[model samples]
Target: MEREFRICSECGKIMFEGYVIEGGWRYYCSDTCLEKNYTRDEFNEMYGDGDTETYYTEW
Candidate 1:
């Protein structure tokens, strides 16, 4: 038998079987989301203070 998965909620991209992790699947398109999750507070350090705002607006 085979299994199926849902698209990432934040990006509307399809997620494949192996991509899912133990607790649950990721919420966004790729490692982009994972990085953002771990380093949101440091966004200013990487891209400046208003960069996070720009990301949401562009999305």
Candidate 2:
């Protein structure tokens, strides 16, 4: 097993792989963090603010 530590783009929380949200090529710890990191207009540009869903994909 491997442990990867990443800083949340919004709140700066320490997170592992399975606990995160993705938007605009960035990783956040939660949907609230994603929302905080981006504005309505900015998020709207990313195909609308998703239903606070966690996006899972490789970086």
Report the number of the highest-lDDT candidate.
2
Off by over 4 Å in 1: 1-3, 17-22, 40-59
RMSD for each model, in Å, please? Answer: 11.0, 5.5
**Candidate 1 clashes between residue pairs 3 or more apart in a chain or in different chains:** none
Every candidate's lDDT: 0.43, 0.56
Model 2 per-residue lDDT tens digits across residues 1-59: 66666777767777664234333346766657767776646655554355544443333
Q: How accurate is candidate 1 locally (lDDT)?
A: 0.43
Q: List the residue pairs that clash in candidate 2.
A: none
Worst 10 residues of 1 by lDDT: 50-59
How does model 1 score by TM-score? 0.35
